[model samples]
Target: MTNYNAVFAATFAAGAGVMGMAQTADAQHAGHNNGMSDFDVYASSEYGFCDAKKIASVWGQSIWEGKMTLANKVRAGLTDLADADIASAEGVRCDWSEAELTYADATQLASYWGNSIEEAKSKVADLMSGMGHKRFVETFADAMADQTEGDEYDVGGNFETYVASSYGYCDAKKIASVWGQSILDGKLTIASKVSAGLTDLADADIASATSVSCDWSEAELSYDDAQRLADFWGNSVEEAKSKVATRMSEIGHKRFVEAFDYVLR
Candidate 1:
């Protein structure tokens, strides 16, 4: 199978298999479910968004108390808690198989396991020792589906975010320039392009950014997009996109630091 098909297969298994497991678990644990397996209960709990909220609240308190920095909390707090929960749930008989994870939880699981779902499942097998591995992988697949359900292959939403975050402002500027050129040549509006989800357009945007040198001065942006970014980043409206891109290029990754960054909170 192609890489994309492999990914699709992994996600499909998680979505379809999770429901089947949930139904089977419910019937099996009908009356005496309370004292059932920890693994099963943990799986079921992931679907309960309220539980995630409670966990977030506790993490907030920890931040307030200076127990951890906001960055640290953002990075590891929830994942750590989830891992702890998984560790505790191991070797215990489960009540239900309805385990569904949040996007963030699934992302962490993927990071821990592997590049692809199959590879990740193998890592889970290492941890699970053949127990609950299939269920965990299925639940993770469910999360993957949730994350990409509507946004798949969309050029504007996740693609834009990915470019900005992964390649920084320099690359973002290049992409915007190339996209603007495409608009001029194809007589396409930004809205139309975004809604179109043309793979060639998306591929071109990525290719232009990755293949070129960073040059904020040469980057193009529509007047509206430039103004919006300018207002958000405290740059003057005159040459707004370039100005914003210049600042981002200069700041680079250090913008995350509390002191060295030029942009205000």
Candidate 2:
């Protein structure tokens, strides 16, 4: 049999048909178990699992980061530099968990093409289909980038405030310089400042500095930034230069420039 039933499965999926037994409407098929239940299988429904669950599974880990994970579901639509970072972290893949299984055709292949050509093609066509052998990679992204651009997250209530207070007064643009999404909590100001100079550094050098010198900080403009502003405010040009020179040597010239900009801003 050509499994014309898979055609039936397709029509059935358009609305409310499911394959194999599952707990929810069609989560098991999607590969994202919302709840911690074996019964909470991937929804196999053509509709729900294909989009929602699949979206959740692959993106679940990637889209999730910083304080957003601490917020309520459907609350934080998506977050800042974390959003872009999640995308950059993504490796090239055939499809998400919700996508149709491939075959020589085996639909479920954790690794490269399996045993036989037929085995390689053994995929779940009803879930997705094509003329014959082909790889289905629709987008090269992992999040709703255009829809949820910038660091101004969509979380409701105190979520934003909580993230800001715990993290700092900075935003996504500040984070992208050194991938500052993981930098929530106490060192917020410092972390954001450390990544400051990296705007002009090469990607590799920036990454290196970020990894090694990540602990630098001005601490809410009260330390280096405040002191510099004060120096330039009521001192002779020589005095100011001397002060700036000292700070630069202490924190490096690039970092000093970054801190000065942030302080003045």
lDDT of each: 0.34, 0.28
Compare the candidates by TM-score and give the number of the best one: 1
- Per-residue lDDT tens digits for candidate 2, residues 121-208, read 3342222322111113222112112222222222211122222222222221133225422222112333333345433332233334
Best by lDDT: 1
Q: Which stretches of candidate 1 lie over 4 Å from their true place?
A: 1-54, 61-80, 85-157, 161-265
Give the true-structure RMSD of model 1. Answer: 20.8
Model 2 alpha-carbon drift over 4 Å, by segment: 1-159, 163-181, 184-212, 215-265
Per-candidate clashes come to 3, 31
34-116, model 1: which lDDT tens digit per residue? 54322233333322212222332434321111111221332333545544433444443321111212223334566655576
lDDT of model 2 at position 60: 47
Model 1 lowest lDDT segment of ten: 62-71
